[model samples]
Target: MTHLHRAFLFLGTFSSLVLSAAVSHGQSCANSDQVPLTKVKLEEIASAVGIGTNDVELRFEDFALETVRPGLPIPHNNRFFFSADRRAKAGIANVVPDGVIPLITITAIPLKTFIHSNSVFYESKAVRRTRLPPSYQKYQILGFLDALEHSPAGSEGSFVPAIVFMTTSDVKAISKKTRLLATVQGVGILHTIACEIPDVLPTENNLQMGAAIVVNPEVYILNISFPFPSPPGSPGRVRP
Candidate 1:
């Protein structure tokens, strides 16, 4: 299908998804007429892609971008709350008078740099509700790599090679430490890190990270540097 047609289809599917989610909230439901962004006159788009003037600001949030409480005819304003970043590209547009085509701005933010080896790896003390699975097998870690890198490789260009963590059943379980994972800053589309452990957390090395993967900057990272400080009488040295 055409891009515009697909965009509209996405809108419909998205709305239906929202309605389904809201129903789970135990909130009363009602059908409200909504307008698509096509009504606002996207200069790049030569013709109307949708009907109606009702539109909501799209913000990347907790489960991907969508209105706060969609399917309801309520006024919600989406003010530009993004700042400059070298890794992310921000886009802006607005509704204007029928005779005027408003100016739009797009900016890219750097969300990947924060995930690099140099960033902070906060501990549980930082306060978080995310509890990953107790143990993640090698296959799981590689699954993540496959999704991120499209395949595990050390090619000429790609996000930094993903370190696959070995299986471990508990946080205290010393499997191995490899890299320094960091939580960054901002409302981002970050995946909850699950499963695996490093053989050794890098204390020194030219360890780099992916250049532009969009992710939340406020997640958590465990500060891992050295032969991990294990419990009393336990093997402190990283297992080869």
Candidate 2:
């Protein structure tokens, strides 16, 4: 057989192998379902926050997820804030009260599995230095919360603290630009609740709100009647 023919045969075999591997991976991912949160888990998470099982619900307005990329470092997650009515009713609403929000978050990453499977080129400095995408970081917080919230009631578990976790690079980047209270709308009754770090150090690594509500002490049962903040120069109440 000619050298060129032998080379072609080897190349064809390599291509076929690559294609097969790709197809297998695609199938595996397609079959994998994103785990769902269960009711039991939610109760556990609530209990951790010093609330009874009945006091907690998975339903929170503006539950969202955000992504983080390298160099641009900010930590965010799928967060749930009480509505004004619920906040009042729950008696956990606070406006800049000293303490942390009694909330928890969890996170998971599929890329870690990918890195584990493909050992080759995994140990490179670049790969080692690379951080989990911002979305994954946020998701980790959600996952942890979800797991705790979904765990079966009566299961032996402790409440997880609210702390933002990220790679050192990301943390440094966030420290420079991040604010203690991130004023956001869509919290319904809890709209005024600020997203701030807890006074305690070495807290859970992620965005967390204090469990206690103090802003409008007179108001109990945060109803969904509050208005959202207005745009710049618009005739509306500015979010503090």
Candidate 3:
């Protein structure tokens, strides 16, 4: 067989294996209803993957899968801030105190994944010189990758944090930006919540009220209601 043909076979096998590992069926995801953003609700689903299902869910890798799950509506999963580091510990701040920022649909991968896959190009001095966070900072997707900026309460134009969803494309289109677009098909959320960070690092356990970057913007989305979302000023606990 040709070298190119052999490479394609390897890629296909690798993709299948990785996807299977990412997707785990949970007990309650059977319904299409927007999963509530509440801690109890999310933990129940996170439990399906054996993440230890604490009162607070801190598994950012597994958390990313939830954001992309077929059964979850874009708005549903966009509820809380997730971090691969978990040290920032922004896991339980559901729906931001400012309340649902926005939702944007774009095809995208984790920034860490995108970087590592292209590490061949950036592996040398380039990786060292680049300002990008390390691969362990998986919650990031590069600053302003979403091409979106949201208005705040009255007059501020703070780029509100958003919940973003990745959709499949049957055909690919090429873009010519060639400099900083995350991907032609990729989309990412920009807020302290997802990376393109909001500088919530100094906050009390990285809770919603502490997210000063987009602090208390007028409600943007999640117009549909859910039961017992975290209220402002009360971040609850980061972990149980």
Candidate 4:
């Protein structure tokens, strides 16, 4: 089958899977209010990734979860709110708490430095893209957030916050090769860039961001760096 044909088939199958699960296991917003956001566990995230509870773990700086209320569409204003790192850890705490269980959306930063340091592991591209079952698309906003609290000081790079809209088209584009594509200032004047993931090499020392790799619709690879130098008189150009 051609790529487009395969993509359509994949979408149909994926939709069925998502719909089936939603009908059987889906919880309502009222249910969300019963379980505190702070009480979310690894199992919840695992479910989000379409993995069994045994397949996932709660690690520092791993996946981020955002709670979206029912009847509300994600990206309501071209932006979404995520729990602070502290709140996230609290929800995953062992102690159960009585409170609203906010509908959870997951996110992560695929930082080159972190990947190079071996602090984070990348999931397979196929698994990342198809695992979630796209029915969650409306309720979930999958993308990366620019580091606002921890960004470098006085860096030339703009630090606007932004999110990526993942689609089949995006996944196919990144799956071919690795290279930086484009950079621009997004929300909050933050700098963002997209790159294609390179084929893995045995001798390679570091895994970089910016290079795209398909890792679920909601997961994003982030490139945090200073803007490139512009020509002598172009706009936003700076002289050394």
RMSD of each: 26.9, 23.9, 20.5, 21.7
In candidate 4 the C-alpha lDDT for residue 175 amounts to 19
Q: What is the lDDT of candidate 1?
A: 0.20
Model 4 bad stretches (over 4 Å): 1-136, 142-159, 163-170, 173-240
lDDT of 1 by residue, 153-226 (tens): 21212223222111111222212211112121111111111111133232211111111111211221111111
lDDT per model vs. reference: 0.20, 0.22, 0.24, 0.23
Q: Arrange candidates, best TM-score first.
A: 3, 4, 2, 1
lDDT of 2 by residue, 1-240 (tens): 999999788666655554343233220111122211223432333355455544332121111111111122222223332223323333433112111222322223222211111000000000122232212222332222222222221022221112222111111112211111111111111111112122322122212211111122111111211111111110111011
Worst 10 residues of 4 by lDDT: 231-240
Greater-lDDT candidate between 2 and 4: 4
Model 3 regions lying over 4 Å from their true place: 25-144, 147-240
The order of the candidates by lDDT, greatest first, is 3, 4, 2, 1
Judged by lDDT, which candidate is best?
3
- Which stretch of 10 consecutive residues in model 3 shows the poorest summed lDDT? 117-126
Candidate 3 — which pairs collide?
107-186, 192-198
Off by over 4 Å in 1: 1-62, 65-141, 150-154, 158-240
- Going through the candidates in the order shown, the clash numbers are 20, 48, 2, 18
- Total clashes, candidate 2? 48
